[model samples]
Target: MATGWAGDNAVQDQIDATVEDAVKRARSQLNQGPSLTHCEECAAPIPTARRQAVPGVRLCVGCQEVRDQQAAFSGYNRRGSKDSQLR
Candidate 1:
């Protein structure tokens, strides 16, 4: 049921949007050209295991973690619908 403001489904919609964004990002990253032998952040060697596990990976494990965290914090602009604009 709706509460004081947005309905209960509003939170569900936000979750769905977040998942969609994550999937889209993962797909684009997978389609990247190639993996780099060395990490761009610390110049550490990118292990073969990581390269094989994550296709088109560019950063080392440590660097990748940091980058991923940064990306997660950078919220998406999920406002393409006309209904959203009406608000």
Candidate 2:
């Protein structure tokens, strides 16, 4: 049973919404249009194999790896559970 004013399915609904947001975020990060022959950030040559494998790739493997490492996740706390707040 849900406590307070939340419905029985409120927890599940919140989980679903959070998952949907993550999926949308991932999709938005995908590059569009034609793949560039050179990396946009480092100007390094983009290999034909990478360009063919990933359509519309803009950065070389090294640059892409760095960019991925720099990516941050949203800090929004959808779950108000005590355990979640501890983290």
Candidate 3:
């Protein structure tokens, strides 16, 4: 557990901070105020149940499904790889 210059829990601290940052970022992306009545992407009518359930629902079910498919990994470093951090 000898981490030389770094504390024993430094690695865990960094991981926790990364998770916290990701959560804050995700929450910040949530829409506030009134939910849109129509899908912003395809101009389709967003259902009342969906709107009530999602709070700030913007996209209709179909468009949202497509978007969810296109989305990719968005998280902290994993599999023991660093990206431009130790340069």
| Highest-scoring model, TM-score | 3
TM-score of 1: 0.52
Which parts of model 3 are misplaced by more than 4 Å?
A: 1-4, 73-87
| Candidate whose lDDT is highest | 2
lDDT of 3 by residue, 2-80 (tens): 6569878989999999999999999999878888998999999998999999998889999988888878555645555
Better of 2 and 3 by TM-score: 3
TM-score of each: 0.52, 0.68, 0.71
Instruction: Tell me the whole-model lDDT of each prediction, alpha carbons only.
Output: 0.82, 0.91, 0.87
Off by over 4 Å in 2: 1-4, 72-87
Model 1 stretches astray by more than 4 angstroms: 1-26, 29-31, 74-87
By summed lDDT, which 10 consecutive residues of candidate 3 come out lowest?
A: 78-87
Evaluate residue 16 in candidate 2 and report its C-alpha lDDT on the 0 to 100 scale.
100
Better of 1 and 3 by lDDT: 3
Model 2: worst 10 consecutive residues (lDDT sum): 67-76
Find the number of clashing residue pairs for candidate 2: 0
